[model samples]
Target: MRLTHTGPAPARRDDWQTLKNLWPYIWAYRGRVLLAFACLVIAKIANVLTPVYLKDLVDGLGVPVAVLAVPVAALVGYGLARLTTGIFGELRDALFARVTQGAIQQVASQLFQHLLALSLRFHMGRRTGGLSRDIERGTKGIGFLLNFTVFNVLPTLLEIAMVTGILLWRYDWVFAGLTLGTIVAYVLFTLLVTERRMVYRRTMNTLDSQANGKAVDALLNYETVKYFGNESYESQRYDHDMRSWVDSAVRNQVSLNLLNMGQGLIITVGMTALLWQSARGVTQGVMTVGDVVLVSAYLTQLYAPLNFLGFVYREIKHALADMERMFDLMANHQEIADRPDALALQAKTASLSFEAVDFSYQADRQILHRVSFTVPAGGSLAVVGASGAGKSTLSRLLFRFYDPTGGAVRVNGRDIRDYTQDSLRAHIGIVPQDTVLFNDTIGYNIAYGRPAATQEEIQAAARAAHIHDFVTSLPQGYDTPVGERGLKLSGGEKQRVAIARALLKSPPIMVFDEATSALDTRTERAIQEQLDRIAQGRTTLIIAHRLSTIVQADHILVLDAGRVVEQGTHADLLALGNRYARMWQLQQSGEDK
Candidate 1:
């Protein structure tokens, strides 16, 4: 199978469109947002008024010493203005906290559900580590965008406007013009530099994801690397990716420093020009010392947001890039989806049929071709074949993991596609050749077959699978922790756990795909006996590699190269002295030796 290319490309810098898409989530808490905006406005007003109080206090100091009350009042008012500004800013953050947190939760939850709803093919092609990292970065991007764009970016612009208006009115047009020109230049420079830095940022992000994917893949296949004695090989591979990440990170930092230096140069030039003009006016007696101080105070206030704008600009670009990746993931369409009008499966007898079916994972190769078979209600069918003869494909087809390319799979005389996938699978139970359990307790793994099963029911199923005695012998018994993929248990023990799980499901139809292949000879015989007892009145399909295991099957099929070459009872096939007879003779001879 081809690996999917799920990584994002360099996205279009259309931040407004992305924000528009996020409007529904933001709109959900519109009331709180409006209140926050009100608080923001109050805070800015207080901030703007603070400088006016400063101007008054400076002017009041020039008054006669006998009248000290004027200067004292101005000082008090200035302090009150600063305190009000801080209070209102804090209130604004408090009011909007719910909206920001709610949006994060809603977006993360939706992305998780969307990933689950995606088709199995999509999952097969994805790298788990990279996918998870994208999700983490995406959620963090949401928080950054909401907080910075709303609070920092918007408030900065508002404060700039208030400062400009005050300068234009209280001072001359020159002061306002200089302030406005400086702001325009700073904005333009920041945007241009930030756009250039985006390339480095994207490279850094890609390298980071590659390193993470490498680490996770290596760890997950730890046993495989050890078996091959390739521990050093794996380490070198991981280090290669990390080295690339380090290089990209250094380049990213270098570009950022250059951008900061350029920004500082522009701010210094603007500040010097403004201060020189204000000093000239004071010397010419056109403006008092108080006016000069006020203009300087205004410049200081304006510089704060101007510097913040640089940080905000960079963060916004990064956030947008991260969000673009998440949105790309969301854009993946499900290859298999339920029809709008699909109904639940109503399997009264659990009969199964594969009629003239054809299938392939890729167009170049077909795995099943015109294969047909049936299991009548309460009847058993055994299919024996060599590897790649399409035995396991039948089980996957029955489970609806992939729809047949041609013809149909039916259950109870109705097309399985006519029913919802969930309901259709609910009627079938399977015990596969390989079993992988969670890194949880033994009881948790068994109870997974039926989440709501009672303790008694779980023990009964364990007894039916002949594993209850083994479990009880342990000190922890059912509560014993099963290590990753149940590696702590022997192969035979894991197989027993799988059997118990299938028994607990207790569906009307059962498929055993080499279920006893992992067990020892003695354990296989015991499990085979239990399996025979369980299949008495169930619709059973057994795919087997060992010919001796199915000698008592109600019907036997011998498949070669995806075709059913022989079909008969064990005695009749042996009497015919054909393929089945040859296979059985060979197996019995090998066992006797």
Candidate 2:
């Protein structure tokens, strides 16, 4: 496996385009969105009118002692306006909750389904922990974007417009100009500083994903780590990744402090100048005490939303970055898509053939060369070869995991590629050399072969593979939990479970690829008897490394270096004194010793 230091490339996307892509999900709840918008408008109107009520109350206070009753009315109106503002804001949030949740659900479901539909080759190259983290962060980002953009950003802009209009109409253009200038300066500073900080944030995100990936990968290979006594080494590797994350996090925090200090400085200077102007007007008799109070109240209200605007802008950028990763994952194309005209496989006699097949995982190195073979209907063929002789490659080719580089693999005289991959695979059953079970109950794993299998059928299959009695003896019987990859079970037991699963499938064509390699001699003999019974009247292909195992096979092919060195019945090949005879003699000699 190739280990690379860098993470997946950052996605390049226009923020508006990404938002446009998300519009469909949001548009589905247009009615709720409209209701939420109406609530927001009502809330902003109440908020804007509250300051007017406060100005009236201050003017009432300046009246004689007999006019205190008028001040009482103004104070009551001010309190009611504030209460209305809060009520409408909460109502808006309630109205939009469904839209936010529905959009998140829809996007997450589509992304998950698309990921599953991707080809196995894509999965082989993916880091599971990192991919899962991206999905999680992306979904959360969607919620933030939907909530803040509609509720916070839009409302803040609306309030700013109302305040600026009020200031311009009631006073001179100087007050409105200063307000606009301060806001523009604050926003520019936030945008420029946030752009600089994004590099640190992205680096932090990448390191976090890498750390999680390393932890999960190590845990998944817990047995290997223990066997190799590499626990300390794994810990050190994880710590090394965490150290990088810490460094990035420190830089991100430092930049955030700089942004906050700059924002505070701008707000402080703007508030001081506006208050100074209002005081001068009052002293020069150009404005009443009430006008001064109104201006001060407006400035206070404006600053609240201004500070919140800065927060909204920063969060919006972060949400876009998170969403970019999710879109990248969705953008990956399917490598092995079925043709539009592909048809379901039609199996009559279940005969299979490899017609002058050649294959290679990479172009630089070849594995199979001009190899041809046939398994007639209701007949068996056994292939014997040493390691790296391409025995396993035959199984992968027959299963259509990868197409042959040249020539074709056929079922029932038709090229396998002509059939839909799902339909073709449904007719073939395989018991692979390594059996990895799901982390579920034993019965669940067996039932996976035929999801609708009855209890009697599942038990019958287990009995055929000679594992039913052992399962029954356990306290939980079939319900016993199989730990990760079935590590709780011994090698021979896992193989029996795999055999039971294949037997339950009962497909027309079966491939036993080193199916009994994990069993002891006695268990292997017993299981071979069951395999022989099942192979009757079914087309079967066996790939094995043990020479003694195929002595009773109807026909045997001996392979060496991707070439067919000998072929015939086992006894006939022994009589020829070729590669098969030499392998049989050496195995028998080793067994005797």
Candidate 3:
């Protein structure tokens, strides 16, 4: 695997575009959005009217009259306003909850599909811990942006607008001026301070992903670490990642405290100035106690969400930062994409061909060069070479994981690229040199080869792969859980499980890539017998290191540095006493020793 781990840059956000990406998912529930918004507006309006009732109640109570009857209407109206504000506020939340959840689900599902669709090159270089953390944060950010941007931010702004307008209309331009100026100051302070604080937040995010990546990497390679006794080294590496997080987190908190102080200072000044003006008006007899009380009431309504508004704005910025990574992942173009006119694979004979295929993982270093070969229907071919002879590249090419840099790969006389990738893959089955099983039950892993396979079919495939008897011996049988990457099972057992999975697939073309290499000699012989039976009447390609295993192949291709050095039946190659004969003699000597 290529070790260049530089992934997409995660911190930069075209905020407008990133937020716009979420719009469609949320807008898919347009009816709910509109109704929820209407409820929101009504709730804010009632919240604004709440103070108006207080003015009347205060005036009625302050009046000097013979009979001081209770102001029942004002009292009841005040209660109703509060009730309306809360009830409708809750209703809005109830209505929009589904939209929030649905958008999150849709976005998460799309991200998952995109991740799967990404090329193997990306997967090979991907830091699993980082990728997983990005996805988790991004999904969470969707919910926060959807709920708070609409509910918290918008409502606060609407309430501000209503309260300022009421102050201007009820009293005079001076009161409104103080209210608007205070809002402007508060918002400006928040935006400017929060903008500067963003660097700290972004720093925290970068370090967090890196730290998580290190932790996960260490854990996944647990056995390797134990073997080397590098537990301290791994811990030090993870701690190194977190040290930067610690710095940034401290700076983030410091900046936040600065921001809060600035906001509070502006709020205190604004509140005092407004109250002082109201006091002067009351003393001058221009404003009654009712008006002063009303102003105070509206101030409470405005500033409560207003304080929360600052926090909401900060959180929204952080949310955008989190989502930027996931969206960047979404923006990553597929290295291999289906042609617009791609056809489903249609193969009657299941013949496989590599036509002068020249390929490379990188431009500086080529792998296969004009290497051509073919396996006719119901025929088997074995590829043997020293390590790094481009053995795996051929299998990947057949699966269309990466198109050859030059030349073409054909399945059933058609360029594999002409067929949709999924369809082409459906026609081929491979048991790779390294079998990585899913962290699931034996039954689940086998069934994954064909998800619709019944228990009977699973058992039959297991028996064919010579693993059913062993599985039956376990107390849980097929229900036994394989731990992460099937680490709980031995190598031979994992190989058999892989074989069973491949058998369950029952594709027209089969590739056994060192399929028996992991087993003991006796087990290899037994599984090889079953493989020979299964390969009958099916096109098969075997990439082998053990020469004896492939002697029965109808043809053998000897590769030396990505070029075909010899090709003939096993007897013919041995008779020539060339590369294939020498390799055979060497392996025979090793076996004898």
Candidate closer to the true structure by TM-score (higher is better), 1 or 3: 3
Where model 1 places Cα greater than 4 Å from the true spot, the runs are 1-17, 65-73, 346-348, 591-593
> Which candidate, 1 or 2, would have the higher TM-score against the true structure?
1
* Backbone clash numbers for all candidates listed: 0, 0, 0
Model 3: per-residue Cα lDDT over 1-593, one tens digit each: 12223233344558899988888998899999999999999999998998888888888887676534545677888999999999999999999999999999999999899889989999999999999999999999988888788889989889888888888887889999999999899998899888788877777777788889989998999999999998988887777768868888999999899889988998989899899999999999999988898998887877788888999999999899889888889999899999999999866559989999999999999999998988998899999998999887889998989999999998888899999999988889899889898999999998889999999999999999999999999999999998999999999999999999999999889999999989999999999999999999889999999989999999999887888889999999999999888888888888522
lDDT of 2 by residue, 1-593 (tens): 22335564354468887798789999999999999999999899889888888888888988999979887988898898899899989999998999999999999999998897687668888998888888898899999898889888999888888888988998889999988899899999999999888877777778788888888889989989999998988887778778878888899899989899999999999999999998999899888788888888888888887898888888988898788788778889976666788889866459989999998887998999988999998889999888899888898889887889999999898888888989888988888899999999999888888989999999999999999999999999999998998998999999999999999998888899999999999999999999988888888999998866777777887778887888999889999997788788888888521
Model 1 local distance difference test score? 0.86
lDDT of 3 at 95: 98
Per-residue error for 556 in candidate 1, Å, reads: 3.3
Each candidate structure's TM-score, on Cα atoms with residue i matched to residue i, is 0.92, 0.89, 0.97
Candidate 1 residue lDDT tens string, 50-155: 8888888998899999988987998998999899899999999998999999998998999898898787778888888888888899889989999998889989
Question: In model 2, which runs have C-alpha deviations exceeding 4 angstroms?
Answer: 1-21, 60-84, 284-290, 346-349, 551-555, 591-593
Model 3, stretches more than 4 Å misplaced? 1-11, 64-70, 591-593
